[model samples]
Target: MNLLRAAATVSSYTLLSRVTGLIRDVLIARAFGAGSITDAFWVAFRIPNLLRRLFAEGAFAQAFVPILGETKSTRTTEEARVLLDRVASLLTFVLIGVTLVGIIAAPLVVSAMGSGLRGADRASDFDAAVWMTRVMFPYITCMSLVAFASGVLNTWRHFAVPAITPVLLNLSMIAASIFLAPRLETPIYALAIGVVIGGVAQLAVQFAALARLGLKPRISFRLKTAWADPTVKRIMRQMLPATVGVSVAQLSLLINTNIATWLAPGSVTWLSFADRLMEFPTALLGAALSTVLLPSLSQAHAAGRKEDYSALLDWGLRLTLLLGLPAGLGLALMSEGLVSTLFHYGAFNAADVAQTRMAVIAYAVGLLGLLAVKILAPGFYARQDIRTPVKIALAVLVATQCLNLIFVPYLHHAGLALSIGLGACINALALLTGLRRRGVYVPSKGWGTFFMKLLVALAVMGTALAGANTFIDWLAMQQHAWLRVGLLLAMVSGAGVVYFGVLFTLGFRPNQFKKGGTPLV
Candidate 1:
């Protein structure tokens, strides 16, 4: 399969998900605004959302996909199918227990996640958060299964299903926000309901795809039998270190969320909104590319094709810089324009936009680092070396908290964003160094020239974006909403043209990526 084409397919579908997600956030902002109520919902939503990342997207995907590739190559079809059944059974049983615990302990979990909500004046908000948490807890189970199916499909070279399934969740939320938020005594509960509904829809579609491909897992109740399978045990063992790595990241996020709750009324919501903006490039470039790279990296490693493995990493790294730099520049320089245009209406006021803009600018500081880690960490994961990343993540977690102490005192929520970004940069550098020391990856020829061209392109793009920011006051343009949207679009489009045009003038060609697989040009 062409790597570029596969990545494009994933990115395209992911773009749809992000667009729908933006609409969801926009509606929520218009309806609810950034306040204690919105904060309650955001804090509650983070629970299942974090677990979805931890289990479904993070540890499970990392541990399961490598082994699945091995099974398909080394085992008989019957054995591979059984492996799926056993793994799925074990995951299902475990998450069901977790869901039950989460529902029963909703108050405790919410308190731990956002202690500020526990204040006397904010007692009702805390209760609302707990209530929403209970309602959304089941979302984890459905999403984890969805992740299982996504891993299966991606390994089977069907990337579109996994990429597109997220749209269901976004659409579900949009519908609930529109139809349900106003009807209830507490409007946010509708979003929690939408979470579960979306999860079911995503899983149903993914399972349907898996069934069509003859890869659907037969979940069983025999815990003993599923646990006894050596491959199942092996995946569990691999998941141990993978979980630690993922948990460390999630733990940092939990701490950050808790800190945000204490700092101000809407800090959590502001940072979360800023996060929605950041996810666009991260999802489109980083996630979309990594989704295609990880499975291929595993396959290449299993076959003992060292050069192919290195080449794949090389391609991902170069592509990350080719696109990621300009993305970061756009984000950092056009923060006011982007934040205001997307979110500055109704309850999302001028103050909210300014606060969110600060966080967005701070996040842009580490955007490239964040994008690079998506490529570099897979270099370790594909080799089944989860321990290295775990250790690095632990260190980064400590570093992040320390930075948070210094930053939170001054920059408040934006400080948290900055710390997370810098920590990502640190993690990416460490991962790259480890890959180099292990002789797993060596830089290819023309890296210096490539770096120089990117620097040139980024400078040109940055200047264009910065100039465009001066022409219109994003906040002042709010009454003329369509004009703000038009100006933002033209600015971004013009910047992209200038950036790539400079790269082409300086000897960059889109067609160069097609030599191995897929024409990215």
Candidate 2:
């Protein structure tokens, strides 16, 4: 696959999903705001989301794809089909058992995560968390299947359907929030219902797409067949290390959630909101590049095309840095204005906006680190080497947990954001350094020059935006809040124009960067 072409396709769909998600979040802020219910809902929501990233997107895809891609490349179609069926059967069995356990332990899980909520005035407050967790527990089962289908579709070179599936999930939640939220006694329940419906819908969408490609998976009990398959054994081998790596990250997040429980009633919600905001850019640029790069790199490595593999890795890194750096700077500089413009309305008040803005700024500081991990991790995964990342991830997890312990008492929700950012930087550095030691990554002479130019352009853009924001604030003092929003939007647009224009004039071809050229921006 053409790496640039795949990234564009996935990025476009991911961009759409992020936009719809923003709308959903805006509506959620309007309805629930930052309070006990929002906290309860977010805590419940994070359980599935953390699991989604851990088991489905992170470990499963990282482990399954290389094996699947190799199978598709080396074996006959019939042989690959049999392998898929066996693996699917085994996955179904495991996920069923996991989901049952999750449902049974929902209350204990919620209580452990949200011990801070016990101080609430009403006894029902604790029950809300339990209810929401149960409602959303089945989501894990559905989405795990969806993730399996997505891995299969990705191997078949049908990227659009898998990339677009998340859009359906976001839209389902949006619809639920709009139509069902007001009618439900507790708005959290509406969001929970949306999670279940969305997960099922996501699975259905992928199945239909697979059927169109004549690759439908049959339901079967073939655990013995899967366990005996050599390919399955190899996948399991890869999965064990990758699971450790993903679990380290997930455990760090769980630690953050636990720390947030002691901060304030809405501390968890504030952290969640900030994370969603940062994820908008991360998902669009970082995730899009990583998702597209993995299969391409895996193919190149499998074929022993070292140059192509290296080129793709370099391209992914440059694109991630170019896109991620500016976004991080912009968010950090304009956190307050951006947060106020987007969310300071309805049930979300000025105080909530202020708190979330601080969290966003803190998260912004680590955006490059986050994107770096996204870019560099694929190199390891594509080489079918998962243990290195697992070791690095463990170190980063310990660092993050230590930071959370030290910072949360002083910085509140923002402390969690800071810890995550610091952890990402550590993880990225470890991955890059490991790749260098293994001779997988050799920085070209042009790297320093490219980075220097990109830094110059970023400085110019940041300065221009900061100035523009000051002017906008001065003008907004004499205008309505809506007018202030309009002015702020104009200021942001102007900043982008100045930023890209300067880079282009400085001999940077944004298009070439997208196509894997040196990062000049």
Candidate 3:
């Protein structure tokens, strides 16, 4: 696959998914508001959502993909099919028990994730969250299957289907928030039910894609045989560290959520809204880059093409800094406008906008780091070196909790977001350092010049944003939604023109980014 084209493909689908998700959040904000009920739903949704990351996308995919790439590259089609079947069977058997246990322990899970919900004042909210968590627990099983199938599809270079599968989740949740919720006395449950529906839809699409690829994963419970497979043993071994490494950022966020629940009634909701905005670029660029990179990196590593591997890493880092810096800066400068324009409607009021904007700015500060980690961590995972990243992740997680103690007292929810950004930055840096120290990555020659150019471009963008914000008055534009959207579009377009225009003048060309078969040199 051409890494750039593949990444653009993934980013396009991810953008669609994120756009639909924003609509879902808009409806949800209108339907539930940013109070106890909405808080409860976020908490409930976060439970399974957390695992969906920790297991499905996090450790499981991280471990599965590298192994799958190696196996597919080295082994016969029949052998690869057998390996896929065993992995699928093992995941199905394990996650079924996990989901059942999660359902049974719903209340405990809720309490752990959102201790603030268990307060006497928030007892009803806590109970609602528990029920929602139970209802959504089964989603983990469906999503795990989706994750495995996606790894297979990605290794096979079928990117579009798996990329678009997330759109189903957004569509289902939007439908739930708009249609199903209004009919229910407690509307949050509808959103929780939507989680399961979305998961099933995501998995179903992947299965279809797999069938077309002529790959069928037979589900069996013959644990001894499956477990005895040497590749299965390696996956489990890698999975152990990969899980912790992949999950540290998420674990820190979960901790932040736990802390936020105690801060104010709308604390979790504000953070969630801000995070949703940050995720637009994070999911679009960060996820897409990582998704494309992992398989390419693995292939390069397996082929022992050291320069190709290092060049890919260099290209990705430059592109990340190129896109990530401006995205973060733009979000920070335009946080209030973006939040107000998108979410300041119906039940979401002025105070909600203010709080959410604060959190958004805080998150935007770390956008570069967050996006970098998505690319950087894969440097380790794609090489099947999970331990170093885990060590770095552990240190970052510990430091984040410490930062949380210092910042939350002053910045509240925004402080929590700042801590996450801080952790991501540290994690990305450490991963880069580890790669360099191990001689696994050699920085391209133009990096110093590239950074200088990026700094200049970002300065121009910042100046442009400050001037626009002076007259735009995003909050006032809320009364004229079209004008708000139009002006916002204008600001983004102008900023993009300045940033990329500068890059072009600096002699950055589209041809610099070529298909994966080509090296940066």
RMSD to truth, every model? 1.5, 2.5, 1.4
Best by TM-score: 1
lDDT of 1 by residue, 1-521 (tens): 78888889999999999999999999888888899999999999999989989998999999999999888878798888899999999999999999999999999999999998999999999999999999999999999999999999988889999999999999999999899888998888999999899999999999999999888999899989999998888888989999999999999999999999998888999999999999999999999989999888988899898888888889999899888888888998999999899999998999999999999999999999999999999998888889999999999999999999889899999999999999999999999999999999988888899899999988888887777677778898889989989998999899989999999999888877754332221
Question: 1-521, model 2: which lDDT tens digit per residue?
Answer: 55677778888988888878888888888777898778888888988888888888999999998888888878898888887788788888888888788889987888777777666573476788888888888898889888889888877777788888888778899999989988987766888899899999998989898788777778787678779999888888888899899999998888778778777778888888788889878888898887777777777788887766777778888878777888999999888787777677678887888899889999999999999999899999989999999999988988998887898778889989998998899999999999889888766558887888788889999988777666555323333667767777787788788877877887887567555742211
TM-score of each prediction: 0.98, 0.96, 0.98
Task: Using TM-score as the measure, name the better of candidate 1 and candidate 3.
Answer: 1
Model 2 local distance difference test score: 0.83
Clashing pairs in 1: none
List residue ranges in candidate 2 displaced over 4 A. 119-122, 474-485, 517-521
lDDT of 3 by residue, 367-395 (tens): 98999988888888889999998899899
Model 3's TM-score against the true structure: 0.98
lDDT of 3 at 437: 95
Residue 259 miss distance in model 1 (angstroms): 0.2
Model 1: worst 10 consecutive residues (lDDT sum)? 512-521
The candidate 2 region of ten consecutive residues with least summed lDDT is: 471-480
